[model samples]
Target chain A: MPSLLILMPLAGIMILNFAFGRTMKRSAFWFAVVLFLIQIILAIFHHPVFWSNELEMVDRFFNVSFSMDYISFIALLSIGIVSLVSLLVARCSIDNEEDRFNFINLLVIASIGMSGIVMVKDVFSLYVFLEITAAASFILIAFWRKRRALEGAFKYILLSAIATIMMLTAIALLIVLAGDPSFSVIKSALGRSSSSFMVTLAVGIFICGLFIKGGLVPFHGWLPDAYSSAPAPVAILLAGIVTKVVGIYTIMRVMISLFGFSASMGRVFMFIGALSILVGAFAALGQRDFKRMLAYSSISQIGYILLGFGTGTTIGILGAVFHFFNHAIFKSLLFVNSAAVEDSVGTTDMDKMGGLASRMPITGATSVIALLSACGIPPLAGFWSKLIIILALWKSGHVAYTLIAVFASVLTLAYLLSMQRRTFFGKLADGLEDIKEAHTRIRVASIILAAITVLVGVFFPLMFDNFILPVKDILLR
Target chain B: MNELYWRIFLNFSFFIIMLFIAGFYCILVTRNLIRVMIGLELLIKAVTLFLVVACYVSGQAALGQALIITLIVMEVVMIAVLAGVVLSIYRHNNSLDARRLRELKG
Candidate 1:
């Protein structure tokens, strides 16, 4: 019964690919909506008693089990929401029947992989699921079969392959040391055993692999291209949740639960996080393409999330996880807005667009809301998370980083507002007289996301109490 | 007796690591897409061998073998898909040169 959460998506993929491939041409979108809704309902209501019972009988029957901690619960919920939103976005953007079929199939499979990653108890299974997700993403990014798409996918595959090799080596070393690959066994083993050169080396390699996956500054070569060239819905999914789940969340879980955070590790995370923030924000300022700027902005926002985790405080981790949820909402909304703009205007180039708000009011309004939320304006969700992170940093005596983070938030606002001014607020550019609002389906998705951002911001205390605090308690326990 | 066995295991592990490094070098230096794929395959083989050796040394050969089979299956699927993608790239550009596929820039 517990396994159904993962299996249902796999089943969806098989059914969509073969069983209904011929009959379900236009109805595929609705079919996927129902499928995702079922999965989300199951995830929310299907918490097994044995997960919290601590019974050996349960362990014997399921040697490999899903964790039912707050971390996994929140991750699962967010994955469900993002996958549903991405599916909706895809409904409007993807027109070709064959392409749509493949997209839904791959997205379902990728969702399974993501669900497995967060829920699984063992490191080996995590690696397997990570690979599954990576493989699916490569195809999704290159689905258009365009030259640029292929190039993006190829770069992603190459970089991801190298990261996989590193991770595999790390896993092999870890298995030898622990005599098993499960998280509990490895944690206990490391606790009993003293840190040695080999252990340190393995941990370093593992973290490096995750950093590349997460698109931290030095290993982020493929990120901009992959995010920019991917179909807009795919970009929304990638920027919104894929990197967060596969990259950032894994790093947090391993570093906190397995290695146990040390001061040196904290310093390393902060330095890297600061570098990514500055570099990503500054580079975003120079982008001509709209999606590319958002891609860079994603890297910058991710830096904030990492920096919060680096503080290793309860409030810090809370802020980080909350920001993770917030980033998923706003970033995906922004990407969808970019898609709406591109679809209506036929290009993502910022210089070629102007004064579109008068025409595409829904897209323009939602984009403004998403951008403001992203830039940490007060009365919005991003502001509260950023405030918490800064407070955590200041409390932890990282005065310099706090200032830098604050400064980078300004940089974020500068680029985003400038982007808004160029694309929507200025005088209408020539040849855009016929531009219309994005498809109703696309508009609905953006509206749903924008509403969540506003509602979460307005009701942040309730959100923090009900959602973020549980995750923080688990992490800092 | 156990010390001698341990020494042999350590020596073999070192050799495998060296082979892995060599494969990594091949990937870094090669410009041809096919050669890079070959390099990737070599790396997978080296990792597979290492997993087997680790399992043998730890007396968990059965579990290790099961894992290795799964790993090999995944590796084969990955390489096959990668090869198809590379072929598509070649067909489109009329060259397998990695340098020529540089349309995206920032």
Candidate 2:
């Protein structure tokens, strides 16, 4: 089954982990990587790709369906690639063996839940999968079992629980009023004549919950803590795929498929996206910890994607997907690279160390590439994506938003460049001569993602046409 | 008049609301990590109840009930495992107030 292709990695991990609880770190890590590789192969090679029927179970109150299509394929590919790289990067912290094993299993579980949520057509099924992903993330954040780790997990759990409940209650109301959850059925029920009050009430609650999950501005209290505390590999998965998949991807899918781009809704999304961009970028500028800064940067980056989608043009949606793909690669690269830096320097405090390029060339070079890609620098992945989004804004005739986006992109570059300077250049601080390069697997992971970032930038059209265009068409339709 | 159905709906709604309030109170007031988790379990149970009752009222019992029960089982299993994890945290950290373990601050 197509579902199995996404789920098999989690199953494989469960077997290997539970049966061979004492397996060597290298074996466990390789086993997970190999499993993901097999998944990637199956995802690419499977012919006549069997999309499962929309399995539906209808009751008076709930109509549920599990459906997969081209959109699900996009999510699957992202999950497979990002998670494999994250796992390889996690192996450098050899001291936390048990935590590493647990983190790998949780990553697999979250990936399965994410892919499942994207594929499922029913709102209720989406809620269930969302919870699964959240729970897995909570456990993974607390994997380190430090004071901060538990605290971060607790905060994340509490906030996510509230958001999930809001989503569930909204679904309940939608089902009670509309009688079904299938995309086609719901849209028909919401036909051109539905009362504005009911529509507003329902849509507002749903969007608020989704915004919280996406870590947009006011609801982003848990993000910096969770991202900074989570193990580097797990952080990569969360930043790269988890937040985007369950939150932004689902919101975009549901709004386009069910709600249509009502003028009021579009304006609200645009405003929220803009606010998130400004707030997230400014907030990130002050962070001292590398991971924490990256966390805030993710929130800002997601704002651009949201802004692109909110523009409601075909070009706009395509640009959003392009940005999403680009962000996933570079952000994951940055997180893993931070792990490498931490592994070598014994700390993530950017100001405490310097001259890392001379010490750890791989981490320094790869990180610079990632940093450049993140800041929309030329000939890198971020630039094309940012250009597309800005062009989309201009074409949409939202000149003000276009200007704001350009401004945000520049601020993004400034802060990121400063971060790079503080961490990599200048004189080495006291007691730093003994530091070495990251573990073999960690370096391999960084180089792979770094290379992909450059390749995707150079061959933008190929990736855009083959990978992003189909998903964009599906969502836009 | 469909009085019986209306009464069932009101009863279930009251029960779900009460469970939610209790869970909120526990999350807000409790100091123990285990208790906090119990509060979460209670909240999830309330959600499940709400879903199932909503399905029944709307006359769609089969799918919702199945999904709710599946959710209940998942919560139970996951909560039990997490309870063990919390206990370990308490052992190592020497407190479960969840407020004291502030080691990873920025």
lDDT of 2 by residue, A81-189 (tens): 8989887776666457776777777777787788778777678777778888888888877776766666677777767777877777677667655667667777777
Give candidate 2's error at residue A181 in angstroms. 3.6
Chain A TM-score compared with the true chain A, each model in order: 0.95, 0.93
**How does model 2 score on DockQ?**
0.34
DockQ of each: 0.68, 0.34
True-vs-predicted CA distance for residue A254, candidate 2, Å = 1.9
Would you list the C-alpha lDDT of every candidate in the order shown?
Answer: 0.85, 0.78
Q: Any runs in candidate 2 off by more than 4 Å, and if so which? A: A17-28, A42-47, A50-66, A95-100, A192-196, B1-42, B77-89, B96-106
Give the per-residue lDDT digits (tens) of candidate 1, residues A353-459: 99999999999999999999999997989899999999999999999999999999999999999999999997999999989999998999999999989999999
Estimate TM-scores for all models: 0.96, 0.89
